[model samples]
Target chain A: MKQPHIQLKLFAALTPLSPENSDRVPIEPGISIKELLDHLDIPIVKAHLIFINGVKRSLETRLNGGERVGIFPPVAGG
Target chain B: MKNTLSHRLNTLALKASLTDGTPCRTISAAEVIHLADDTGITGRMVEIAALREQILPDRYLRNMKTLSEADQIRLLESAVCIVGLGGLGGLVTETLARMGIGRFYLVDGDMFEAHNLNRQLLSSIDRIGMPKVEAAVMRVKTINPGLEVNATGAFLTSENADTLVGSCNIVVDCLDNIQSRFILEAAAKRAGIPMVSAAVAGISGHVTTIFPEDKGLENIYGPEDQLNMAKGAETRLGCLAPGVNLVASLECMEVVNLLLNPQKALRNRLLVIDLEDHTFETLQLA
Candidate 1:
């Protein structure tokens, strides 16, 4: 049996956290938002907002494959 | 009273040789000043001048389609305080001035560095060392001389925020740091004024309207200690012009909506936009 993967879309300050500056990345399904952030080298502390399938979610929420995840950094710039 | 105001306006219009119901044209600032001095009533002069000169004198003529003349007048009489004259603040002030806001109190303690020219609307090479608030005041004066702008070249803090934001009807948060933003939010809350906050970095931005009773910046950034340990997006990814402009525009719209149609404002909702992928989503805040 093979594990499923979910797609991630990193936005704003979170883009730099991704390797190669790719806008989209694949991650293992069932991984919590916190775990996915860790895998992508994005400090969970740096992310201020997270959305899954266009809905706001907590870091502890688990991701299912085929769902789109968006991560945003706190854009404090004027 | 309406008839008297209209009669005074008509007399002024006749004196200026401005025909009624014509295309918008400019009225010399000198003429308006003289009328203000003669009548001893500046408001009536402004009203008459705005109507006779059409769009040019009114400056907000286009706003008539969306806002009633009374609403437009309300805008002209409203006072808004902009905290931070960097990227977002510069654009917000520019748009608000053009919209005929009556008064402004601009707060910023920083001087324009070479790097600021990349996004700050009031920043130019010649103004590299000028105070941001000074530059903003100069720009506002150029945009709408009728507007009264007070430039405070001091950083907003817990001590001074109350004095700076207390008198204004609305507060715009264009700050670049969480600490300053929190300070501003607290002051705004204490003053019982609504705050329109916008922030951007890279190709994404976020906007929200927070009323006095709302949790505001706290809901988005969490507690101060947690935010203090985290770096802002600008520090990590830098900022771009498009992101700054888009967010500022939205923030300005929110301010206008808050003034003219409070029921339709973004209030309690966080609008997040990712220009990179063209994704815009509004999340309901608790």
Candidate 2:
């Protein structure tokens, strides 16, 4: 049996995640957003918004294997 | 210079106190002598007793006025130039305006959009489509009519950067784009004025005091190319009032503290705040 791989994409300001700054975390098959965050040690409450693939998702949303997740901090502008 | 404390106190008596009960007083040299008498520091017939020492005491005395009329005037006369007039700029402008800053040069090419109401103080349904700088002047005047505000409804670009910063003592970079930030920072450095810059990425925000002589935006944030390469949106991505105010409050604190003590100010440190976890920390940019 082959193992599934997961990719977590990080972005800030206008800068997207580069190979140097990106983190590749693998997970066992399918994991929920809450579980994925817990695995990354990220506080779910601290996240302003979360994006799984390209669409916004809530904390309870599950993540499919090889899904790219982007988590945004709160919006602190003007 | 004559002490104007007494005169200002008299004027303040007529002016209603702020919600905080602190009378907004803008003093001048001529009123210092009167202040000295009212505060029991001067006599009607006594000679001016070391006026300089009387005004600027090394230590603040309890229950006694620490600043003389002249000192008060000088402090209030300080001018701050804020560029962008967006979320961070709007908050910074409001804070400084309420702090009794004597003058401000408000610059912004953008107008109030319906989307801005989420975080911008000057944004409203009626104000939507109005220039940001114009609305800012009206709002600030309502708070402190004595404030000398110059609303320039023009975008801040590298071309006008020199002229914009030449006369202001301090420049605040509240712009979202890196190109503008770099231009404004360069202009401020050339003008020999200090700049307090703040930026936010999602819930993470950074505040730093930039002294042109020492550390600068370039060396700290890296080159323009590196900054531009990063992906961020200028439009608010669900901008919340709490988050904007949080960063604004921090920026305001640094600005006010710097105005009070320019010589001993926050320099070369990036203060980052994460409201999600209520975490506030400082990172040194060396």
- The superposed Cα distance between candidate 1 and the true structure at residue B187, in angstroms, equals 0.5
TM per candidate comes to 0.85, 0.63
Model 1 lDDT per residue over A6-74, tens place: 557777867656556343455576789899878777888767777777677889999766777777777
DockQ of each: 0.62, 0.13
Candidate 2 global TM-score: 0.63
Most accurate candidate by TM-score: 1
Q: Model 2: runs farther than 4 Å from truth?
A: A1-78, B1-72, B230-238
Deviation from native of the Cα of residue B75 in model 2, angstroms:
3.2
Candidate 1 Cα outliers beyond 4 Å, as residue runs: A1-7, A16-30, A39-41, B1-6, B14-31, B37-45, B48-56
Q: Where is model 1 chain B poorest over a 10-residue stretch in terms of lDDT?
A: B14-23
lDDT of prediction 2: 0.63
Give the distance in Å from residue B142's predicted Cα in candidate 2 to where it truly belongs.
Answer: 1.0
Task: Please report how far candidate 1 places residue A10 from its true position, in Å.
Answer: 1.0
Indicate the DockQ of the complex predicted as candidate 2. Answer: 0.13
lDDT of 2 by residue, B161-183 (tens): 88887878788888876567778
Q: What is the TM-score of chain A in candidate 2?
A: 0.72
Give me the displacement of residue B234 in model 1, in angstroms.
Answer: 0.8
